[model samples]
Target: MFDEMLHWPFFDERHRALRALGDWADSALDDLVAQEHAGGDVYALTPQFVARLGEAGWLRLAASLDGRLDARSICLARDMLARRSGLGEFAFAMQGLGSAAITLFGTPDQRERYLRGVMDGTRIAAFALSEEGAGSNPGEMEMAARRDGDAYVLNGEKTWISNADLAHQYVVFARTGEADGARGLSAFVVEADAPGLSVIERIPVIAPHPLGTLRFDECRVPASAMIGAPGDGFRIAMSVLDVFRSSVGASAVGLARRALDEALKRAAARRIGGRALADYQMTQDKIADMATAIEASALLVYRAAWVKDTTGARTSREAAMAKLFATEQAQGVIDRAVQLFGGLGVTVGMPVESLYREIRALRIYEGTTEVQKLIIASGLLAAASHGN
Candidate 1:
């Protein structure tokens, strides 16, 4: 089912990545899967996975040296990876998200210093944009950075950051003015060991990953560490997200596909009343709906990626639609898979049980489903007014 979707014009060339990457993942990421099923220490496992992915050259797909990203490739990579393991997709996605600002809008010196480390997986990276009050609304950010001589002294905290304590470097956004809201924000690169910066609290989500809050009390970073110019943080962050948001949808497609596959296999094998579960009309109805939703989501995912890669346009409307539908629907697909498995589905260590936990966070992060609706409607209103 997934292979057929690759024939879409969006991925004529990049679709080739699926086969090789999928084969590599099944073999190389087996240990990661076993660890996740056993509820292993995700923090300890993160670096090991990064090193392995880097050594295998998989991380290179996430870093764009020329500052031109191929969204289809990114979507394909995320789709294949998420189907296998949630943590695997998280590791790969962070390499791109953490350094995307630098890759797209950094000085030559900045790129030379940081891009390669992430591509090679030696530098685990984090994107610190969400503060306690700014999870969905970044404009409400209270984290501040005051200019001190040639350095910027940062203060306040960023919470719910992925790859938190495990990251070697962070792409941080903070307020730089008195009260201009998001317009006063600036983006900067700060190493983990930077003075006066520390992980204040580790946050455990429904799924396993390194998430936490970081506090900066007079943390001084060189002025050169800034990505783009002052007042460019909001633009830079939005630009980066515009490209990666569709990739999030692709990840949802992968998760949904995996759920569908699990459901189909179980229906074929599990029997009741002296017949296979797949023989029942109720089971067949579910299989049909899950397949339809997966295909619809996959089309939206690739369409958004294609528009970004080919047209170089801001995919606010398209990406939001893709994200809103894919994540929300994938949750439903995975839930049905769990119901199909009955008592065994809720049991820990079962594949559907793990997936149930994994699918919940995707809806909440990046941009929430509610946030996506606003974006889509805003785009529609703007387009209508412009007569486009």
Candidate 2:
């Protein structure tokens, strides 16, 4: 189904093989989703699924063979699993996002101890950056860490954290001083069983995953848990997001593709005005729009992915553009699919409806549409001011 993407030549033979592996997953994923349904607990089910993905060597692709984050592999895995199942994509992505700090900046000892397990899926990873009061404004976070002896005592609450209950370890960001704003923030690695760490509550969404609030009351972690230097948390957080945000767009493309596929099947089979719905020019127009949206979105997503792979540049602007366009366009495409489906589109258990719910969160998480716009505009204005 993704074969059309080969036209761009953004990928190599190994990437094609990954796509084939993803195609193999299409049949098997129903069983995984069914198993998830039987358990009825995403928290419990996610670790097992992640472990299975690791043992199958798919999770290994989250990082390079030597254990650094692999941009292309991360993008490919997300796009594939997203096409199969939204939850599956979430499970795969958190591993890469959660481990990215260690991959990029961890000490040798840290990588030896943590990243290997993350790559093998023996350890589940979570990125705890968002707080109840600090959604888009990272500077507003109240979570603070103060040093005592060789440990940092973390105190405050982190909300809207994905994999909160299930993560074996979390890369948490907190203010390291009384200084105001983002400058005071630092990142630390906290174990699931660390002192004074607790899950306060689970937050449910339209398309649910493992999510909850994490409270840290004097939660102490060794100083060695800090990634890079203190006062570098903001850069680290932005770097991780810059890399993965494009993949979020890729996932949107996947969801849009599924929505388009379902709509196409319905349009071809359903009769309207004494002929198939596909026979209508209006239906053809909608299909054309959806197809065009997918194609254009794919171009943006892969271009960002490729640029990162080849240039090793900080991709803040490129990633912002990809996420901004693909996600918003996906919303439009899916809406058209639903319109084409009519009442059947809104029906529960329908693929397009699920895609609708799944696609909504992609726009909100990673970065909101509004946030992406700000990033893009700021970059453009900065470049203009520099006469570049």
Of the candidates shown, which would achieve the greatest lDDT relative to the real structure? Answer: 1
Error of 2 at 20 (Å): 2.6
lDDT of 2 by residue, 1-388 (tens): 5786865678887777787658666765677777653445787778877887777778777654353565666777787787778888888899888888878877878777877777787889999999978999899888889999999999999988999989889999999864678887888889999989999999998887999999999998999999989898988899888789999998898888888888889999999779999999999999999999988988898899888888888899999999999999999999999999999889877777877888888889977999999999999999999999
Query: What C-alpha lDDT do the candidate models reach, one value each?
Result: 0.89, 0.85
Estimated TM-score for each candidate: 0.98, 0.96
Model 2: what TM-score? 0.96
lDDT of model number 2: 0.85
> Backbone clash tally for model 2?
0
The RMSD of every model to the true structure, in order and in angstroms, is 1.2, 1.7
